[model samples]
Target: MGRLAVGGTRDSVGVLCQVLKTGVPSALLTSLSLAQNNLGHLSAMYIGDALAAPALKRLRKLDLHLNRLGDRGVASLAEGISAGGGMPCLDELYLGYNKIGDAGARAVAGCLEGMVVLRELDLASNAIGNEGALAFAMHLSDEGRDEERMSHVRPRLLLETLDLKENRIGDDGACAFRDFLACAGEHESGMGGGRTEEEKIGLYCPKLLNIFLDQNRAIRARGRNALQVLHTTRGIRCMEGADW
Candidate 1:
């Protein structure tokens, strides 16, 4: 399936829903790309409902890029993913484009509250501003600020690659991410029920290695300077604006 492009179609999501209802466990269905489809909010809900099918248990990769699934559709999708036990095994999510703004980003953030399975995520060019970027950063960090307070539970992601190449993550947003990385770098794990130091740095979700922030035009040397904190640790790569 080379770049499964099925845009401008409203019925495909219906067909997908029907297939999902067939009760055939989609253990082999690892990737599905319905990007560029103006699969609007209503159609997106159909997709969301389909995702709730038990047959689609093993489904992982989902690409809704360039679709018109605005905040409402995204929220619907998030709700479906969370209900009835949720797709806990999902690893990669591509929600680039599709006119997702900060509100939608917030919904996505809410969806990831306790999730820690995702490894690669791309929220590129979704009109995400500082608030949205900050939301994503909150989840992406290796660890939270207060892990000692809640040592009994595991939180956050194992994200390795993240892309926020466009939209509006200005200086403030840039600083937020920089500080988050700094905190992760300095984080030390406790020997109690807490996760290992690497996991805590990433909130028990380490292995974040690459980040792309190209063409935002707002991040300059000042923001880049703040990013130096990440360099203090090894195995991390970043590309900001034209410097990449």
Candidate 2:
């Protein structure tokens, strides 16, 4: 099967893990959904190891949302995915509503540094605060800087959609993304030239089109306005729902 969807009991997931380990039957699987299963951290570890299995090398999209894989589980999954050159072809990942906090967010960011083919990431409806949010913003900013310096060798992230809604992110966390996407402080450094608009913006995920930061009540007027400016004047779309 090229796609698999499981509501996922622990026993069923365990069996799937065994199949993945053997690298059979799921060789053609490109998408897998285990959403809303309440599969806690232990399941995450098993799934992570299964992801590294050679048979599932073609997998691209993974949906683990609402599995309750808290900080410890996320860290374990990150480690498993990063180790042994796992999930090389995978792209989209959904880890929302798993009780992830700052440390888990940071671990996920670290894992992402290696997944250059990654596109969309959904971390919404979790416990991410300023520290977690800043981790993401800074990671993207750092990647952009690296791309600017080594345009030829470095692989740029193709991330387009980042959903961080219903979290604890405050203005400081929200504005960090503003600076990263808008290249707020970089222009003042005088990196200007005959470069294109995207190049002028420091090559930091220039393809990023939308970011969802709504429902984060910690964001005040200043942060909200700043993101709105990005959506209006700049090319990025900051908020989605009509409630904003």
lDDT agreement with native, every candidate: 0.68, 0.78
Which candidate number would show the highest TM-score if scored against the true structure? 2
Question: Global lDDT for candidate 2?
Answer: 0.78
TM-scores for all predictions = 0.80, 0.85
Error of 1 at 175 (Å): 1.2
Error of 1 at 170 (Å): 0.6
